[model samples]
Target chain A: MTFLPPITAYTCVCAVGRGRDALRAALTGMVGGLTRFDDPVGVLDTFVGRVDGLDAVELPANLTDYDCRNNRLAELTLRQDGFEDRVRAVRDRYGAARIGVVLGTSTSGIASGEDAFLAWSGEGPLQSDFVFEHSQDLYSLSDFVRRRLALGGPSYTISAACASSTKTFIDGAQLIAAGLCDAVVVGGVDTLCETSLRGFNALQLLSPVPCRPNDADRQGISIGEAGGFALLERDEGGSGTALRMIGYGESSDAHHMSSPHPEGLGARLAMTEALEMSGLRGGQIDYVNMHGTGSHLNDRVEDRAIADVLGPAVKCSSTKGWMGHTLGAAGAVEAAIVLTALEAQIAPGNLNLKRPDPEARCRPLMETVPAELRHAMTNNFGFGGNNCCLVFSRDDAR
Target chain B: MRLRVAGISVIGSGMVDWGQAQRILRGAESWDADALTVPTPTILSANERRRVSKLVRLALGAAEAACDSAGLARGAMDCVFTSALGDGAVTQAVMSALRQPGRAVSPTHFHNSVHNAMAGYWSIGSQNHQASTSLAGGQGSFGAALLKAALSLSQSGRPVLLVAADHPFQPPLSGTRPTDGAFAVGAVLTPDVEGAAGPLLDIEGGVNGPASETDTKALHGLWQTCPAARAIPLLEALLNPKTVVLEAGTGYFLSATVSP
Candidate 1:
């Protein structure tokens, strides 16, 4: 595997807050962002990590056709943490055509589709104003981002369920390695949609209350909406203290679509491959950001996979309790949290974990603790048995 | 990037398989404008077979054909699945259910509604633990998947499978997001050219270019209506040995130089 470039700039927006400072506070303070479900469209009795002020958002006049809840969320996130200005600076250095855009999203602007469907009287042509290309298409997020940022390089959107955004790092690095771009904006955005809300409810995976990951009494997941992004560029002899992506691994379980493999075979393979690629032993990993969705099968299988690969000593936690399971955006959102923890030299404990499952072998942290962190790993497993593991390291620590 | 096309397959309304597609493109067989009949994927178990949607069957059918053409094990290569609008039928079904008094979305439909549902089913049927990525580049999905597969092959020095498919949306959705037909195309790409069954292709270019026109008019304008139909010109060039540049969408172009 090729050595990935450092993350030059990164930012995120969720129910907790916007920008890194807000995320840092949420992590260190152990505060959550979930709220009770009260939307008129949502009929389920559950909690959601809904971002505020989307209804008032307005896209630029030139991009009016691209208006949607998901794009609004993307627009909101891009403006936070000076992300847009930072991207502009890189665009000046690398040129607009030299920087690529790769975003991950599951639902895209499907909420707009739902609205259009709702407004239909079961008659003639359903609202002519509904633009499927600019809204509901899976590539809409990337398209809007690319145009919003005025980038002319190669762009695409990954939609591998929850593992969507994590895989963007791998693809972005490959794009640079293949000489397609000098830098790639990689991240994900998924907005609250009725389809996702009612769909998870149908599947019996939605927890009525806030998600309690790895808890003995944990129910399921609290669906959330979030958007996160990072600018990746090749290391041109930058400062030694820069945060860099050391390695990444991806795999498929070939077992089930919605359920994880019982033995966590694919998860183990992904982590093991990431370790091998980074040239580090499993014990060298100081902390791990687990994909603890609070679902029974997910947490259990992931715990087993971590035990098999990183062993039982590594400190692990799930931040979903802070911002529900963001689905497609979970990978990048958690990635931002991992970077934050690495910078502060503090490992965040599982937000909602009370009594860890007795069957689990890996240790689940219950309280945020300061630690000497060098290398960290973040795991994201998605539906369709897709699994991705990414390793990050502070150059100074290495 | 330079890679060898180890195998190729195509399935659509009239183009049932690669061989049949070649005959039609070569003017040997008449283009049939009949409704598409998606084949059942035998690679999957009966239990899984019963759960697959029409889009899944179309995608897996093309994928299995490509693997067979290359004499490659389905479990060996990494895969990239791309589609402009994935399983729209399921999306409509779920949304229609949400409109009712009780939004009773089917568990099965909800699960299958994911963009990566086909990728998930592919892994289960193939039992391949290799990395599989599902992505969308809107109308440019084919070019994006091809470039991604080429990049994967270059990075891992291994064979990669590329599959692109899109099925027509129903009723209300069909009004705005109209797809004239359903189509899928698959190819196995390898870094090594030695003993390659298909042509060696020099793939280059990126987003933003003029779209390419298909030389074969007998197939009608299916290429203009379906995203996957854009692969027809390239598939024709694959069998006939020529240079072809295909516009993936308004924003992407895939230029391929085929060497037999």
Candidate 2:
């Protein structure tokens, strides 16, 4: 497959910080963003990477129908890093009809649905003000973003659990390759809600303290909320520092619904296929961003898969310890982190690690250190055994 | 993009399978409004069979039938699943549980709440490790699925399985989003026509046109209520080849020219 386009601009907002600079400082300082659970939903002892100042967010008068926590986070992120202006420039260059919008979200404004459900008196119908099409529908995220960015091209939302956003890159590229669009706005957004918090609690996957990936006594995951976006267009041969998505691989485990394959067979296949697609050897990969949620099964299986596929010599780490597991947003958030590491020419260390697990095979970075990287890979595995691996490279590398 | 349909399946009220549905479309049989009955998938283990949701049964049942009709290996082809509202029953159950005094959610309900739960079950039952994607485009979900399937086939140069399904929501919640009944459709699309058994489809995106409407009263009712039923016009075109256009999103339509 030929390279489709390069990611010209990207931005993200999470518990760590708002833009690239803020995130860089948090990563370099090894500071985590988890706080005690203070929401009035469930009675679980856990920590969450919650974003600040969402209640005060207000939507435009015309788009009041699309108001929700998810879109609020999307609006906040779009305002940062000048992403909205970049999208408008692309729209002007190609026309609104030529730019597509493809976003990934697991629960698109379902929090509103919960609210409506709670408001019901167990009688006639839901409140008159509740609009399902604009808020609770799975297509709400893409529709809201497309309308907000003023793009008229093909738009859709992917909902494959945690692998949602990473798969958006592949979909965006496919749309461009098919000549359906010239440029695509690809990203993901997920907000904190009672359902996800209580759901993870019921599954026994929430950690009481901040998550510690690759640690000897890691507890579990600290759920997080985030929003991230990237602009992908055909490379016209300009910027040397441009980061291009070289290759991607997706696969399903076919083993279990909630549990990953014990041996990480699907994970290994995704990574190997990505490497093959990029035409890169395992030894050439400078770093790996693992989908380590700090879960015992996830970290152990991923460590084995990374060691077996990318080899134990390559440095790797999971940034989830910094901002917690952002569920659907993890893929895009981690991809942004990978791009930051490449631009800074440094590998970030595991944030909450004290002692590395003795059974782990992969070599994990324990401190932030300077290094030159040409190509890097990031992995995101979701519920129902969905797995996706993406490879990013600098333009100068080719 | 041009492609050939290798297989097709549809399940809904009184529309049991593709064979019966074809007869019904040809005016040989009558449409029934009886509640749709879903069968247990033979591919799943007994343990999994008991755990699967009604939505999963509807989706996997249609997918299995399509692959069987095409004589294609289900495990080898990439799959795309689309739904406007995924598993309304499960969503209501989870939401209701969350409103309880204890606010304790069931693990089973929580795991089944993901929009890709059906895709997960299909992969596990068929043992297909290939790429699988689940998507939602509101009322335009069927068209979006077709567009994605066409693009994926062109990119991979392989056969693709496309499935669209939706189930109704219960009362109070139904007031906000109302779907009449359960509906699902599956088709195997291939770039090459070497082993194709169905009509050739010339699909193009970004076409400015109005969506086609169905004259059949039953089908029109389904089309008005269920998002997945928007495929009726395309399905009618399959029986009698012609050009059909459907809304792909807010401002554009996906036009398909069907040929024998």
Candidate 3:
């Protein structure tokens, strides 16, 4: 984290829209992207941030077996913000074998696996085309991405539930720092699937409506799907406002299997460590993108941690209202949102926030506003108390 | 990207600990059936032990053994755990439920279904607050984990407890793509290469580079057996007088040298 690497280029496709322009417009317009959904997975009265046009999309002919909801989402996003060209340019500079690929996901291609299971129940034994090794294993996403890019360096999938994608940034930065690979292609893709939906529903954590994070009357999460990709480089050709990864901090609560620490102690440690790694003070931060999952404990605990780090005055917001709770994709998705906001020197507001949580000490901005931004931070916490915080600074900050 | 190791601990049907592993690597003994018995962790509470998946048991067992041999406290070590197949049983339970009417997944099953479940349980059980991550690279998971751990230890200047485990899939899934039972391998990588009793290794060059190969062909079963077992051959080369090499990435070889 001391000598941080530059993000250089990034792209995202989520429920909000397909590119950075779409994300910036939605953020500045106070628009929410969540929509009502009949349970594609099961019986659940809830909202989701499901992407459109995935079913009509086709994977490259040679990569037909890699087709799935998750990979489809990744393909949709990879074409955005000139991300593919950026990757190819980096490839030309550093040979395919010198660039590593790391991604994060929770249920990966499980939706395809679910289909295979349903097929088995009907046709007995899955078709050879099912390719369980590629579809079911968490490494499939990384494997698919690596093949798509034709990269031969280090590649793997980090599957730590909600914190997956956020941790990928840490992975990419560390790999570049360690000289494992000159440049690391890092990000994640997660699609709406049966197990994640019904699992949260079974836990009664899904809200019946679009989530309203930091609201006093917030109920629960509205699940969503999205993909975000970033290229982190050690070389110094990128411009200012190019979205550099400056600091990363991660810790586990060792306190819960599925819940946050009552005091957000792990969250606090992660945020504190991120700031410490950045060699910047909390007062120097211009904006904060909170996790703000809208679940009972998540919003409350995360707000407390934010207040502890940035104090009452630092502007902060949760864009989950704009993209829904993207689960594993949220880390990269929200980081993309922060990057868009940073580019415009504006901070996106917390959507659906009418009243603040009474017990909360920090309140997110209710609407987007243009401002000066030098340093920004995004927080992502996952199941098993895996907490991660990333710090990014304007290019001039270097 | 060299990983200078101070100690190692291995668990499988063939090797029980680093002592046995060294003996096998030195060609003093032979690898019979891998009789790995992943114990319920003494570090975890009774309820926590029951709550974790079987894969977690294998990883924790191997991890505890590795840390003990290196005399490194579990809490002091950062971890990078790798596996080819995660907890297949939980995945089976989940997929089966999805096939049913409402797709009612058990919350515990869903939580434990993640690849990092093993690392999560280890963090909670061992109280290691340092950075811990879990990942997979298909059959090359061990190489992926090894290179990462070596560089991390070198950068952080702290001892790292690296481990990899794999248990075969269950049921119809297993019928299609079956693994060779369960096995785990662990290494305590320390930056202190100057004074060490155990063998030392230097990750030398890149693809098609200089490194040693095990002469005893019986040990090569690990390459066909467990994905993490690929590290076993490299571990074996460490005990031998000759330097060793392993395929760290596709078309990229890790040229490693062992100390006398």
**Best-to-worst DockQ order:** 2, 1, 3
**Off by more than 4 A, model 1:** A39-43, A236-241, B206-208, B248-250
Q: For candidate 2, what is the DockQ-based docking class? A: medium
Q: Give the range of the ten consecutive residues with the poorest summed lDDT in model 2 chain B.
A: B213-222
Docking class of 3: medium
Off by over 4 Å in 2: A39-42, A236-241, B193-196
Worst 10 residues of 1 chain A by lDDT: A233-242
Candidate 3 lDDT over residue span A146-254, tens digit each:
8888887888888788888999998788778877688888889899988888889878999988999999999899999999998888775453435687788888888
Each candidate: what lDDT?
0.88, 0.87, 0.80
Among all windows of 10 consecutive residues in model 2 chain A, the one with the lowest summed lDDT is: A233-242
As for candidate 1, its clashing pairs are: B208-B251
Query: How far is B255's C-alpha from truth in model 2 (Å)?
Result: 1.1
- Candidate 2, residue A37: the lDDT equals 90
TM-score on alpha carbons, each prediction: 0.97, 0.98, 0.95
Please give, for residues B118-188, the per-residue lDDT of candidate 1 as tens digits.
Answer: 88998889988999999998777787888889889999988999999988887989998668888899999
Candidate 3 reaches a DockQ of 0.60
TM-score of candidate 3 versus the correct structure, residues matched by position: 0.95
Q: What's every prediction's RMSD, in angstroms?
A: 1.6, 1.5, 2.3
- Model 1 lDDT tens row, A23-92: 9998889899999998575567889999989888888889989999999999999998888887898788
